[model samples]
Target: MTDQSAPDERGAPRLTTREAAELLGVKPETVYAYVSRGQLSSARAAGGRGSTFDADEVRALARRSGRRDTSPAGSDLAFRTGITLIEGDRCFFRGVDATELARRYSYEEVAEWLWTGELRPGARFTAAAGTLAAARRTVGALPAHSGSTDRLRVAVTAAAATDPLRFDLSPEAVLSSARSLIPTLVGALPTLGDPEEAGGGSLARELWSRLTAEPADAPSLAVLNAALALLIDHDLAASTLAARVAASARAHPYAVVSAGLGVLEGPLHGAASGLAHRMLREAVDRGSAVPVVADHLRTGRRVPGLGHRLYRGEDPRATALFALLEDVPQAAGALAAAREVVGTTARHAPLHANIDLALAVLSVSRGMPADAGETVFAVSRTAGWIAHALEEYGERPLRIRPSGQYTGPRPPQPLPGLRTTP
Candidate 1:
């Protein structure tokens, strides 16, 4: 039994049932109801007269119960996720600084770290020969104009079809599939020469060759690695949420990834990089960045690469990437144009250049295709989606189901419903 007259560890008083009920503005029976529902805690009273509750707990409950219930439209909803945390202008993955990870670690290492909480160096991301062949054939079947992301989606679908073990949802099996899937996806893309030539190296090297004809120099490879690491995950993004929802249904990993890709293809998500690329290219072509920024702002539309919903200052990923891009000779024009845009936009708004702008700068500098940034985004985010899927798989199946608040017109009376089909 808790001491009734004595103080708590913090010197707070314990309240009797009558006192708790009075504090909460409810009957004594309601206090018991709160305890039964696990919303409040109680202890045996001194001399076994009755139960006593912590005064602080009672006060907290009272405050919560008395608060207004105003649900704003499109307001942030709370859900538990341990994947990534966006704080101020920076992002962290599992408490590790993402910018630091991008600079020091390979994409494979980062993926493993995010997936299993271990960052093993020299981990291989190789695909089975048969799976590689199947993915290549799938990519080859697409039309000539198919974008890189489209090829990736097709390859994932094909790989899933051929892997007999794809149904395994165990953590080890899912991670094993991912290790092979990422490398195979990279190798499967159509390239100028044999894709095999691009196969035996870090994922960044492999992807670099597929995106452009340039040799995988050290600096370029570093930028690619950093980009991949930075893009690997962002907590509860629309695409990641979709992936989690699918996994909550106990869908296989491949299917979960496909669901994520379906959402990532939208203009406002993964494809935002492509839009930013075009806008930056326009500025570079015009020889002055002000006009492009002015046009976008004058239209009252969001400047594609300039702002983020989460960050109030320069995006840390953008800061990291821009610092790297500054040393590359080819990036000079695009970097200068980006600065002009940033300077001009700062005068009228608070938005700053985000990772998309940095991606556009990289693509322009490297002579990659306009959609190359989106492909990088999609491939990198596959790791995050897989991680989130693993998390969702451990939860109760279909737990994300949300109920709607009905605001539509009520059903008409029988006379009005008489014309309805039987």
Candidate 2:
């Protein structure tokens, strides 16, 4: 082995085979074995004669090998992300409190922050005319009964197919595509009024027209903006993970968003708001919240939008959005219904209102479609999915694959006729 203490031209320390072996408490040959088994990486020596291993990789491998536990059940595959964090009842986006961000910033500003880690107050969010036109045509082709989220999926797929630059995986290109994609997605959905009336403006104003025929009022617009900001990012959520998995395979940003949407359509994720909306509608129709809550509980089913897996207290996003709806005349009935349901649950369980509850209330109060909340969730979460995809693009590909533990029947011996001859 060459000099063990030598540094590469970049001034980083690299260990020789023997030195790495010694540090790992193994023979030099064993060090080569580790490299062969993909446990370590090596580079050529300064003289270009011998191989030198990365000191950090060797040390990490040594530590991993020295651990006694090898069971997969006790270990987990986790991807580190700098996007968002949920601690207790609080949520943060890159160390900034999300509630505060929601209160102070528009959804566009917040989404820009999440994607680029910088707040550009003057940035514009607009899609190409051609892309928007294509998306609208695609949305129009879908069945009239299609949900907002289904239209969104169709739009994204169409957008991906139309954009020749989508395959560009660079951070700058991906972010630009995302900025355009979001607006096009909101614009493509069937609106309740003349499309021209929903002219260029904030995302909330644009989305408001799609969800309702009512004019854009300040209180309702603020609630919509806050909802978008608060929902922008949540660390490694199922949909976000799906986006990251596609990103890990080097899929385009539109395709990454598509992957996330596929997962978000599940009842347990984005569609939770639809169920909550139904619950609130039942309460409104029954003229009593207690009965609805009790009936839902009696059925051995969870109260949709009542509890969150990550929050021990109330969900902060729920609190923030609900606060915005407190005094609106349209929201009064829904607010009362939510209070009754919450009060009833408080007596027996520690369940608290989550973001889905707030979203459901927003939909009911504004007289939006039952699936409007899910649409908001899907659109807002697209920003997060893009952020995660950007992060995953910088990582080594195929790193998210997880090993599975087999717990089924043992492998059977091949039948005489089925066996292949050597």
Candidate 3:
């Protein structure tokens, strides 16, 4: 830690070695351990402040100790077996165009496409509707006004827990997983199982209506369906990677689904929907999104729903999704204003709305609660997870361990009465 004797231009005082070590909960020896390991950089005081270290470097020391740095994932250069591809601008479920599927297909149709890679002729949309209906019923049976994420999480965990066909990771079983998982995690209102009836057309419309209290008009529903199509898959995200890895390990469908959900719980992947919503809300509050973005840039903030690492140009999906939301009035003004701000203030390229931003627009315009948006996204993305898992199941087993560059002392024998430690 550096001294707090003088504040920097940012008006934050520097930290001291002891204070930084204390914050890291490591002894001074371990702090030196980090220094010796070339993990933490230390600098002598320039103006009476003691040796200062980068705050993130100190945190890296903590992460290295725990081995929980599961991020910065490896690229699958050697393996082409675990990925699925969508070839065109038009969204395709399996191989069926999503726009066509959206008009004529049920949610189950989309689930089948995701799991089986084929939208068969005469496919029934609600073959597994009973299971989803049961899951929704289970969620509705929970205590009133509970956090929807928690409730959905618990309900999904339990549904997977109780599933008898979970270990059958066959195409049909994977499709069944999607069908059951989506409606259960979404649909805020209760839905009873209707074995003889499949939720199609108007039934699909009703499900969309039940997802939010806001009236589902043409624009909002179209935008939401488009967002669902857009987010249904991406090329090997961490959560998608986790799902594939689990399937590669020969884990069953439920295990793969659980593993995917677990990855989604991380901030980098699944938590983005909530953050995007918050950013939109901030943009709305400030009246002009450009100034808000300028303020954020001035303060060293990263724009949440703007740029992506993979797509250097504008995200094509964002443009397509925004077009779908053209008539959505609720948050349309804010989105439009933010886009205008992006054009004026951004230096790299004007901001491009990501899937998170699109989902945020759909959720806000439909009046779904802020918390429910993520649940809906998760439910939708189960398609991609199942697809990736299916792709992995066909490949060789995955062993994802990396070599460690050791920096510790050699092993030593213990004396008598010394307790063994892990």
Candidate 4:
């Protein structure tokens, strides 16, 4: 229980100078020094004791002295924040280089690295592994031959329904959510078995494992796992931003995750990969992909799988995904061909493939069903969305209200007992 009597008029509790100094981990005299420095406000004690300071003041001082402060270095924006930057050339997760981990480690290791900032080369899952298994059973009950996108939509929504504790955003809870959800969603893929066995490892690992049905070869599984890890997160994309915004409103993790799903339901974001797939399917049906692409360019004048709003030259993620797609037969030739066609026609357009286009190529090359590309995209983006949501939840409340520019009449005036003619 908290002390109610200590609070002043505004409900902010007043702390004695000793207590304030204790909170700030300084000497009692240092509290007086802080008052002299204009950093703290002090009041004369009620019963003729020394001065007392507001608890809020003491709390602020404690926050200011914390080891890992995230107050913005410099920005005019209200919530200027030090975004966790994962450098990619030498490749870092948070701050540690990921290339070393990626080369020698598994997707599970990478996920741990991303969430904890510490590279646990050998972390055992005990209870989390069991939770993942349960989630897989729930996913396996889903219709196997269902459209990948629809299945994902159904499964995620349903799984979220069963999870009552997703509202808690504690590190352990959120991490558990990630571990459980990734496997469950990934395990729900059609080829990953039905309620009986599923595959080897977690959902992300299982999905990667099933990507190559060639008797569970080690190298293939590793490549697939690497792909999943590489695709897991990106900076604040639209869906991720939506999730973060939802989280900022103190929405539950499930609701925040659902917000990402809602954004992904939009054609311009999550469905973009599906659109790219359809465009390819249309090109293939017409016998020659290049000519068909050229004709579409001539008519629509808009290239489907090229150009990005952010990257003027080339999307770095697209480049990375293309590199990962190199050995996969489903992606190898077709992606190169599509890139060539897009490059030739959209020369002036300067269109560069975004992450969606690259994922589409990878999905198609791997013989994943048409909707698999979108399913994978949604699953991958959720990681980033959850990360951003966690970040938003750590900060002060945000105010994102909408106001109209008012292109209409100022205010409606009531007629005085007479009807007006148009």
Number of the top TM-score candidate: 1
Clashes of each: 0, 0, 5, 6
lDDT of the candidates, in the order given: 0.84, 0.85, 0.61, 0.60
Instruction: Give the alpha carbon lDDT tens digit for every residue of 1-422 in model 1.
Output: 32354356677888988888888877777777667545678878768777888887788667655722122222212345678988767899999999999998999999989998888997669988899999999899999999888998999999898899888899999998898888888889877534555767889888887887766667777888899999999988899989988898898989988999999999999999998899899999999988998998789877778888889888999999999887777889999988888988898988898999999998887788889999999889999999999888886676666557879878773454555677
For model 3, the run of ten residues with the poorest summed lDDT: 69-78
Comparison by lDDT, 2 against 4, better one = 2
Please identify model 4 stretches exceeding 4 Å from their true place.
1-105, 122-146, 192-197, 208-223, 281-288, 346-348, 402-404, 415-422
The numbered model that scores best in lDDT is 2
Candidate 4 lDDT (Cα, 0 to 1): 0.60
List TM-scores for all candidates, in order. 0.82, 0.81, 0.67, 0.67
Q: List the residue pairs that clash in candidate 3.
A: 1-15, 1-16, 1-17, 2-15, 2-16
The stretch of ten residues in a row with the least summed lDDT in candidate 2 is: 67-76
lDDT of 4 by residue, 1-422 (tens): 22222667787778877677667766766567556544567777766667878886578567644512222222101222233333322234576444445456666676676666666876523324444455556656766565566656555666676678977878778877776666656655556323333454544445653343434434434445555565556555677767777877888666777788887877777777777776666654564567766777678756566766655765665665566566555555667656765666565566667666666665555555556566766666566666666667776555332233558655676565976899
Residue pairs in clash, model 4: 91-98, 183-203, 307-351, 307-352, 330-365, 331-365
- Candidate 3 residue-wise lDDT, 1-422, digit = tens: 43543344566564567766776665655555555434567766566556766565566456434523322123122233323434443334445555555545445555566666666654433324455556666776788776555565665665676678887867767666656556555543443233222235423354565456555566666666655655677666788778877887888766777787788866667777777677666777667677766766789877666666556655666777677677777867756765754565567556566667766666655556665456656766777777777777765565443456668866784555967999
